[model samples]
Target chain A: MNETSRAVGWKPRGWDVLNIVLLSLLALATMYPFYYIFIYSISVPEEALKGVYLIPRGFSLQNYVHIFKQDNILWAFFISVARTVVGTVLTLLCCTAFSYGISKRNVPFRKLMYGAVIVTMYISPGLIPWYITMKSYGLQNNFLLYILPGLMVAFYIVLIKTYIEELPAALEESAMVDGASYYQMLFRIVLPLSIPVLATVAIFNAVNQWNSWVDNLYLASDLKLQTLQMLLYTYVNQQTAALSMINSNSTAQTAFVMTPTSVQMTITMIATLPILFVYPFLQRFFLKGLMLGAVKG
Target chain B: MEKTAPRKRKIEVPLLVLTVPFFLIVVLFSYVPLWGWSIAFVDYVPGRSILESAFAGFKYFHRLFDSTSDFGTVLRNTLVLSFLHLICSPLPVLLAIMITNLRSGRFAKFIQTVTSFPNFISWIIVYSVFFSFFSIDDGMLNKLLYGTLHWIKEPSNLLSDPRWTWWFMTLATVWKTVGWTAIIYIAAIAGIDQEQYQAAEVDGASRFKQAIHITIPGIMPTFTILLLLNIGNMLNVGFDQYYVFGNALVQEKIDVIDTYTYRVGLLNMDFSYSTAAGIFKSLVSVILLFTANFVTRRTSGRSIM
Candidate 1:
């Protein structure tokens, strides 16, 4: 391709330099906010008050130490981890089994079930009804609220089903000939072969479960059920309110080293760090998942 | 295969047993909510069964159109935000074209990775990061504008200003989503025939000309499909971004359909009114979806559904 382009006399132009420069600026704009927050979170509270733009002036771990001392933050972190692990596992199992069953040509009521599932991809009953229905199921303030309603996501089912349908039919046929039960075939042969799609779905669901806080905000109001996202949300609101109050009353400053701004930025980093850690490795799956979704649509 | 047909028939029951539970779960969670739409039509008391509630037919629905209701402001906010989003929808396509045009593969990959990072984090974190940058007193932007540059006499709180809320929220949404959205267009661009590009190059076309003539047209179908889907989702301006950014000062400007429903239903305990608002939103969404699908089929000879 490079030789062909060269043979065609394609040469670098001024637009290439302009494009690279402009996109680099855009990337910088996207990244600068996170960098600013990280520096502010690490700066000494008193020094940060003078303002932090690029780098920390007097480095301190006081904000992190203070937030780590808070039991609620620890508990929320635990809840977030628990929900992501359980939610992703349950979603993968249910969606995989459901998709596998529906992928078969002769499953009873296959079209009807598939149609029902696909219809949900376009229409939602809106927020009030969804919340009311969940409340009626006694899911309010329950941890099950996080995992139950999400288990059979229609999009995941469609992705997995499309993958299953594309697999070589001979493997399943051979397993059947050996008298492998349907469950055994699904767990042993098809599930193993569907790892790529499953990995894609797993990453999507895990990120979703970790990042979601609306359920924790609305359905599960119990303090113990708060996830890290919810805790960060509450802190954001609290800090905003407090900042306004401090603006009005200049005497509200405390002698403590852990300022609300520092603590808030710390919590924000805590909430985001996990995704940042996993993102580079899992990004290809996200791209593949998007293409699969687009193709399916 | 023929010999195992009899055994396959016998296995059907177990298959049904394996899948039926999931089917039931989907039905209960997804379809049963449709039954809750009835609450919009009646006087829905919280403890009472929806069927047993007093039959005040269409009272709350009428209230949605009543002059005293907040629905007007809510609808205005929803439409304005959706319109802003629709007008800016081409940004991702432009980004995709630029990324694909880059000669350095490593640089293109780095930019894609960095830009897409924001999409993975929660809106709460977005709010936090924005606050650190734009907060009035010690915010980075304020510090630069007032303290360092002396460009402004007073620190401006972009987060709290109602006038800029719509534009600010739209910018935030675009920043968060543009890179992720571009991935679809990138995939579409990849699917374009390589021969077409070679032919264009052989004709002494500049890279810019090739991109304009070939790449953009190649992704137009994908772009149209996504745009139509966005139109279908116009009423759903999403709950998280607005919810996290909302405050008393900007509440009027940022209260879209979803947040309005939440406030009235969950916060105020006005279950019936909220359900009515929800029903209105859902009905309009379905209508818009069908209309978009119709337009797509007419224009492209393909249907999303």
Candidate 2:
């Protein structure tokens, strides 16, 4: 009732109008790139070449069709999904286990282990040596390449540990007095209480695994294991590849296809859409974790 | 206090067993990579045993410092880019404040969603967007400048041009990242005490003044935390964005230490030289981190590591 009364009493002032106008302009500018991509993806090829198509010159699905028909896209998509899921799960388990152990009041060698973890977060040993080590371990051209090195995200471990520490000590203490083992209390009490942090870490890891191109560039030499980001990298970064895309789209076999502009935009949309799809389900937990660090810092 | 004597208590069998995998994995993957720093001190043959290779101490480092080396250019590019990003860090804080002050929640959320969306996409995919706006023949920028405004005599492929690489990379990155960064500040503002604002309002303080004196000050700790971390990370201009955006024409202007290492290590197969470069980069960064942490601890009295 108080909030409602305040809202009703708050009248428009000179600054309020200025704020609204400024915000509207910002909203338009912030969204213009996505809008540009959308219209270009659907625009008629001839009209697209002439100039900007604020509205798509023609309502067309040919760009998406061409993108779908491209070779290796399905395989690449499969690799992305498989890596994202496998990587996130493994990373969470590894991170949570360490976080749990370190947070325990009675754990032995806790300070030393925590120091070991924190050191890795700051010191990035050069990539070349890491590559050499992975090759020695037989990770090159391997499907497990995506799953192994990423098993422990040091930063997320710190975050999860912070959350676990804040969890009511009494709750865990009572469980311990009932003769619960460390692992039992972890699986039963700690994890259930830490779902929001877990979800936030999961989303972070999943998006990271999905968007990473570095691993594929250096490690995934075999055609079968290449991720989607690599395909996009090669297509857009190389002028010759882009020229071929244009030429191929103009051919009789692809005569009805949208221009190279449309295909580029469509592929980009496909690459980006997966994260946005999962975002809604995870947003509440993400917001919770965002506040957690701030409130407690 | 619980016994500081950690060695007296017998370690639990199950607890030790369960955590061994995490322990072994970190040492193997994280610490073992550091072991590769030895390659910088010796000639590393890909197929041969690293032990069999002859020692080549300091040669690569000398080469890097030589006049003909691209190291200077790469360092300049990296510093310029990091400086640009550091300068724009305040933009996100301002954006957060603006969003907090907005009259409508729906519009604020909508703006945030749009702003943070680009961060989800990889740099590779972002290059496609860059292509559309800067292509020589039919790019939106070219059309706007040449056809409409008559600003330039000839159409230039702004995306591919060497001169525009620094500004383009920095601005494009800032565009994609500012929203994600701003959310941290927003969370900090939300965590501020409500009584301060109420008290200020009771004293007839304006919203603008309240925001300036209360809201901004409240988020200063968060800002300092981020500032210290950013300074610590100033040396490592990440590889992916430069690797995907760089062309032969703009190689000198856009190449960073990470990408330079990649080209030297993988494509050119100068494994030893690249390892030396990587080791050098890491050493500098570690020094920067300690220095930045010390300064932050003294000033803000807050430290991360």
Candidate 3:
């Protein structure tokens, strides 16, 4: 292609060039910090601290191994995983079912159900009251506390309802005319076409649940059931003391004890990896879901 | 044709039955706990019977606004932080617009993915990232500045400085959710009819002029709706992130309403007082939502309700 032909297309001008540069710079600034930390996690502690940018000076898996060495870290990891899976599935089933019901014109007491859901969304009984109620219900120190409270989010329901409302009513009508009952229509017609939205809500909810440590920190006094984020918090707070202990021992045996900073990064990576892996798969749907929700609101 | 002669009003038993679980869950969790709002008026002890508890009507609320409560500082922090976010939130909109204007689709997608990567990671991870960049000794930010020029003996404690913590919180928050927020605006812009832009261009408008006249006006409704919706949640700062990021040095500036409630209720065991504060926040949110909805209906001919 000739330069003039290329320029005739969308070759950016002066201001556009500046915009691109500034944007890329900001993107790098936002992104490369995490990359630096990721590299630091795998590098030897001292060298990592010395501003080595290319790669870890002395490459190692010892940091990840040290994180694995801690008791309950693995258990907390599993608990977090279990919480994400169970909480998301439950949220999907209940919220979607309720939303589907409310969206249908023929559903009984639809207005009342719709009002209840909206009320729940807009007027939460505040944190303290909820905490007190959870305590009264004897949910303290239990895994159910984390999973149950977040199982049915109203905003997610509204999003799903908005999406379902846009779906062609003729499909459901045709299914019903063919002797498919309400349940049959729901499962066979509604659920099948709702995958894009289901995946979108599922990914968003899963990320939220995985990152939710506050509920556990508030309710679960038992360390055994703490989520990964809570464990990471504990790790951040204890890093200084850990560093001192490592410095005290000059022997090579202590080299195996990875720096707490490295462990901190690893914990962050571990907590974030699932979402990162699942994001691209669901990104397009999520953006669409959010736009529809925003526009409808 | 004869089958349609009598339109039946059939009872939806299966639908009702199918919806029973939703009602049960809502009643159990939402409606039942709603009754616990009575605790705001009394000295609510978790283990004690509700009947036995002393009914100190308005006493806890009085304490919340009293001089001893540090209530002024907490409210001020929440308002300032939220107002600042309301202003700063538009930066992401601009970023999204700029990215969409770019010629390279691959670059736009890459920017979107990486910027949103932070949102998936919890505040704990953000805190760790902050430390990596701002830690006194080993931080890249400090090291790079120090290496270039010996400005000071040690790196400045960016997170600990009360004057700077709120901005740090905002930066961390924006870093995480900017792309997520931008995606909506981008979609809204995308949805604008292309014929309008063509008309503007055909009328001899420049690219910038076309954007200003055609594109922006088209997405005005989306912008207004989002603005109103965001206003509803103005007081609800991310408690987990703030609590994780806060420390002794920066607590004064960063201690928002949510964190304040947690500290008072869970840490100090002042349940009744904290409940009052929490109720106050929720009440404000409800009012904002209603007011915004009213304004939107009056001006824009649309309503969130």
Each model's DockQ?
0.49, 0.43, 0.45
Q: Which candidate leads the pack in DockQ?
A: 1
Off by over 4 Å in 2: A1-14, A44-47, A101-108, A165-190, A239-255, A281-284, A291-297, B1-11, B144-153, B194-212
Give lDDT: candidate 1, residue A253. 55
lDDT of 2 by residue, B1-305 (tens): 23345565667666765566687898999998787888887888898777888998898889888999888888888888888888888888988888888778898887777676777778887777777678785578788888888999999876778889888888888877887788778878988999998998776666777778999899988888788788888878798788878888889788899998999899999998898889888888888889888988898887756
Model 2 residue A120 lDDT score: 85
- The sequence of per-residue lDDT tens digits that candidate 1 reaches over residues B141-205 is 88888998999999998899999999999999999999888877888899999999999877767
- Model 2: per-residue lDDT, tens digit, A18-94? 77777677666657766787787777666777776478776777776666666666678788889999899989988
Lowest summed lDDT over 10 consecutive residues: which window, candidate 1 chain A?
Answer: A243-252
Better of 1 and 2 by DockQ: 1
Q: Among all windows of ten consecutive residues in candidate 2 chain A, which has the lowest summed lDDT?
A: A3-12
Residue pairs with colliding backbones in model 3 are none
Candidate 2 collision pairs: none
Off by over 4 Å in 3: A1-12, A100-107, A161-189, A242-255, B1-13, B147-153, B199-204
Sorted on DockQ, best first, the list reads 1, 3, 2
Alpha carbon deviation, residue A109, candidate 3 (Å): 2.6
Backbone clashes per model, in order? 0, 0, 0
In model 3, state the lDDT of residue B144.
Answer: 73
